[model samples]
Target chain A: MATNLTGKTIVITGATSGIGLATAEELTRRGAHVIGVGRSVGRCRAAEERLAALNPAARPAFCTADLALQSEVRRLAGEIRGLLAARGPAALDGLVNNAGTFTYWLALTTEGFETQWAVNYLAPFLLTHELLPLLAAAPTARIVTVSSESHAHTSLRWADIQLRRRYNGLLAYQQTKLADILFTAELNRRLRGQAPHVHAFAADPGLVDTPIGQKGTPELVQWVWQRRRDAGIPPAKAAQGIIALLDEGLAPRPDTVYWRHGQPRQPSRQAQDAAAAQRLWALSEQMCGTNNGSLS
Target chain B: MKSYVLITGATGGLGKAFAVECASRGWPLYLTDLRPEPLELLAGALHRTYGVPVRWRACDLTDAGQRTALCEALRSEQARFGGLINVAGGDHEGLFCEQTSAQLRSIVRLNIEATIEMTHALLRLRDASETFRIVNVASLAAFYPMPYKATYAASKRFLLDFSLALRQELAGQGVTVTALCPAGLPTTPACIAAIEAQGVMGQLTTQNTGAAAAGTLDAALAGKAVYIPGLLNRLLRALGGLVPPTVVAWFIGRRWGAARRDLGNPAESSILVPEASPA
Candidate 1:
């Protein structure tokens, strides 16, 4: 049966480019009303135009917010919640927590957390928690987080959580990706028992030639991948993998990792580790400046 | 209205199983492999048993020219390939140091390069009208780094990552890409020998070709981007939390190292351990 995406409202972060933009386009084309969250007004406007061009019948709303900043991420959630609340209960269908940062150089967000962990993991953590009411309003809501293959190598450092002691851009990225996996796993665990209507999933784009990889003045990894574009899969295909999980009929599996090719790859061991996931969840709550009660 | 299915690595044990299963499903077949005799026999057996159309091509997928030629042949035959099962891939059982430049190139060429080329070609030909599906045979080794099978693990990692990205990119395009990551499937002679030699026959589950392919195909259609063939594999994959890859690699390498010694090759020798990410 064809998925009934009509009348479904989906909010996608990082919808300005690559997988996020492609997913927005695909979802709109499938007849869903998309509300795009991008950092820049210009980029958001451009995305709005693209959405209009792709599916003129589906006029997607655009909101500008720097996802790396907690205040902005919070405001975006409030704005989305307000928008959905205005439309009555069960207005939104999904939220694609796709916006993320890959800092090549060691940097910290204004919140004092590592930039990658803050943007890729914590922002979504706080944003989703804050918008739980709006998500719950919907009959069936899906939260899709775009993670990375780098997570396979990540080992969560409890003492030096931010990698402040010893830092490498790739390593930090991997840790955050691991955090995303752990976050999704815990999210699903909580959702399965408490919120059956809400389903959580994680998707990775593989080794796409994205700007996130072209970090630190493009000298580091550009040559490695530029030489291998033909070998690497495209971003458009990766977006489809994310959407498959959002499909209405997609089976609800906790701790599932969706690959770009539409199959559920096994997540890194940390993702499926319930004890680790719980610890990570607790840590994430602390990092996001939220109390344990918020998620509970 | 005949439906045609494509199988790469049709000569291998697992690939042959997919061929047999698809033929049993009453689909006409387009099979490719490096060896001619096995490919011919697999096709003949399928044709004789299922009474379905079967086309066999012996082409080294590592060679781009040969892969392209095979794809062109399938296209020219007016075969609207419904599904593509990339089964033609294997590991060179050696340490990273033992792998010659040529051997490393062959591993990359056969496992990663062939998969990317074939999938890209099929993606170009696919549309919503066709029930398009892609199944890339990756290894659980793709999950993490293995000291013994470094290149093979990296290649599988590349496939797993690519499969995740491609699945999302092709959504609504009506094509599904599946990466099958299985560990220690005692389907072939090589696998059985390796299991016994390692005494991991206790730890490993010997899944035959038919069962593995069935699981692969079923998961692929269900839009599963990565499918580990067995329940134990799935459980271990989820164990990523408690264990780290470094630790797993250390333990696995030690065990395989001992096994290699029993095989008359000491710890100094090469062992092809398919990398499974720490879980």
Candidate 2:
């Protein structure tokens, strides 16, 4: 069924490449206004051009920010808010927390958090918190956070959440992915029953062929990702699951749901735990210094 | 043939030290790490200082695909490694139950899986006629059954045993495996804090990262099977061998327990302290 989204505006992070870029293309093609966020100016401009090419009538917008840095994330949010305000109230229809990185080693951001944790988990957490007002202004808004099946590999490490004591690239990636699901669950819980209610969901795109592991990876690591990419679906196919969540006509589902291949599936027990979700929410707020009343 | 000495975790404290030491010796180098910016900076500095060819790639070694791609890339570049330094290893310090499954998995993947895979791949890429030196960074923890650092200690033990076995197996092929088992080295600020948390023992056993790197390479080139850096660390390893595994674990657990207490319960604090409610 072709869903008409002519009046809606959505923001997507990491929108210049992989599934993120694909999702922006799909949404814009469906007549929705896409505010694509990317790191590099050149890439963002290119992505904007591609989206415009996809739908000449609804030209997609682009914003540049390094989502890895909290300050950059805050600035990006302000820019998004400004755009939303310029379009009048109720402009934001959806938000897609899609930017992520798999650091091969433990690297820290300027903010002193692990790079994977900061970029994958905290960036989205902070961005969502910052943009909640714009989302709330809409009659109905949705949040789709891209998580992974790798969440099952690890639960939250409260003690060394930043992985300061021990650091492993894969483990850090898993921890951040798990955080995404937990964050989605808690956000849904908090926003429940509110006017213009917000629906938060976590999506597992599965392994798709992307530039994520193509560079800056060990030979063996690259080979493994390549094999997975060979067997995995393309980014366009994976974007379907995200697009499904953003479909307003789709039947109302649970406030917090994990979507896999465009279907709702059970996430890990830890991901579904309300208490853990709450804890993660609070911790995320603290880590991001977003403990202000804005995210209550 | 353009020969290079490849170092994993090359941007890290001990890894960086090893890079500098190798550069001092005028060895053409190839460094790999997760961070490209620092690796590039290090490579450029080394090249300028030593006038040797320095190359680097940012790679996540835990991913099997990246590892394969790295091998292919090196092969395509016609790169031959005369030495392989597996200096990348990490530990999540806490009770095993308190640690996340991800942390446990990382300890094994980076320390054991990545090490083994890198060695296997590089062994195929090394010059057959040349004497190849391999340095695997183990730890004094490898000699003990540590409680709080269970996974890390176990992974180091794997490296130590594997290095010894491989050393003997590859002796005929002119390859030497040197397992560097040093106690606390104040490599990073976190490591320095960890050492301080152990009180007197950590202070007494701690070795300078530069010295440790220098000593390990020197011993590896000398065909030593194992290199323990500090005298105090060597004595402790020997003493640890004299004690029963249970007894050693008990003592180490007590020490780590203190460290954990001093570090405080970061998990509890974050969860309990509520954020300001949304207006």
Candidate 3:
């Protein structure tokens, strides 16, 4: 079932590859204006060329930023605001937080945060907080954060939230994914009953055959990952869960909802905890140094 | 071909216990740590005592390049790992705002990032026909909010969650992930001091490193999702669940806040103490 997204503008991070790229292609094919965000200028340009080739009339755009850095996220947000403003008010229809990384070791971003925590969680957090006004300018808007089923593994560590005591790559990645869900839930709660009808959702695309967990991995691990990728679902198929949230025909669920295969699915108890969600929201705001007005 | 149990942080107190416990089981061992001398000594002792093959690698798990190098070495050796015990973790005890960026980053890298990479690398080496085990060393701190040990507690929380989540993800593949959440272990001088400072609560909750390691491995092999060492620790964890997190934070803040005072460090004390009224 194809849904037409004509006359709507959407921004997707990590739009150069995997599910982000697939979603961009799908949205552009449906006649939506897509501003694809990528890490490298070359990749962004390449993605732009590919999108152009796929749909000549789509006029898809591309932007570049290292989402791991707060300064870069702020800059990218400003660029997006400028682009949307030039197109007049009520331009942005959706924002997708999809850029993420799975590190094989503990690495720090330029801003001094754990790499996975910075890129996968805080980057989207700061970007969304910065772009809320633009989103609110639209008649109806949606924010989608790409989370994972891995969130079920742990609850929030309120004391050592940044993992100052111990570090594990998978655990760090899980923390970021859980943060994505909590962030979405808190955003939904704050935006509910507000004018402009903004909606926030977290989506699990399941394990798609992507280049994730390949960098810095051993050949044997890569081989096993390749096998898993072969058996896993395709990125295009996985991306539909995100696109479904943008569909107006589907009746709206709660403000903060978890979606899988285009249907709402229950997340972990921690992910659903209102108190944790609120606390995480406050902490995220403090860490990112952005208040989105009401949140402060 | 005899399979080995790979253990990280083999130079650490709990890591040593896991090594000894597995050696007693007559299992071949592959041990890694940042310091080569301790790992080599441990490996030689284990080999002589248990008559089992012991391989030692001196590599810093916090470095991406080094981690990749270690993974490549394991692949080239065609090493088959039947079990992986992630026991490498440390904590920077202070208000999160007061800690140096490098100190905080090291904790995250060592505790969370290194464990994930090591597990992924070793999981690739698993023999599909045999059962595989993974025991992650989380802390009972994973269950509560500790203001003074914020990042450390959060990292353990991550481990607890990741272990349970991976358990389900790999259940069909015959791999079991277990999280060991021990309350306290006086493993080092600093740990001993911290435990002593906690007074009665620490006395009641602390467990021996060897017992915790052995129990954790047994529970992991039994396919248990979580293993909290010590009866008191388990009971405290249950009680923790009943209290509101805010209350837990408040209580822990008071406890750790006093410990910091005993250490005579006021720089990190502001997080827990209420501010003084203006004159």
Interface DockQ per candidate = 0.01, 0.02, 0.02
Off by over 4 Å in 1: A225-230, A252-260, B1-279
Per-candidate TM-score against the hidden true structure: 0.50, 0.54, 0.52
Cα displacement (angstroms), candidate 1, residue B196, comes to: 55
Best-fitting candidate, scored by DockQ: 2
Ranking by TM-score: 2, 3, 1
lDDT of 3 by residue, B79-159 (tens): 888989998887765667878888788888888999999999999998676789999988888887778777888888999
lDDT digits (tens) for residues A1-296 of candidate 2: 14646768999999999999999988988988899999999999999999999887776899999988777888998998887778666458899999999765344553335678879998989898888888888888889999999898998888667564455667878899999998888787778755337788899999888878655444566687788788888999999889888887874485547989778888988888888888888767656666664556
Q: Is candidate 1 or candidate 3 better by lDDT?
A: 3
Candidate 2: regions farther than 4 A off: A193-196, B1-279
The alpha-carbon deviation from the true structure for residue B252 of candidate 2, after best TM-score superposition, in angstroms, is 37
Instruction: Output candidate 1 Cα RMSD.
Output: 25.0
True-vs-predicted CA distance for residue A158, candidate 2, Å? 1.9
Indicate the TM-score of model 3: 0.52
| lDDT of model 3, residue A206 | 86
Q: What lDDT score goes with residue B170 in model 3? A: 94
Ranked by DockQ from best down, the candidates are 2, 3, 1
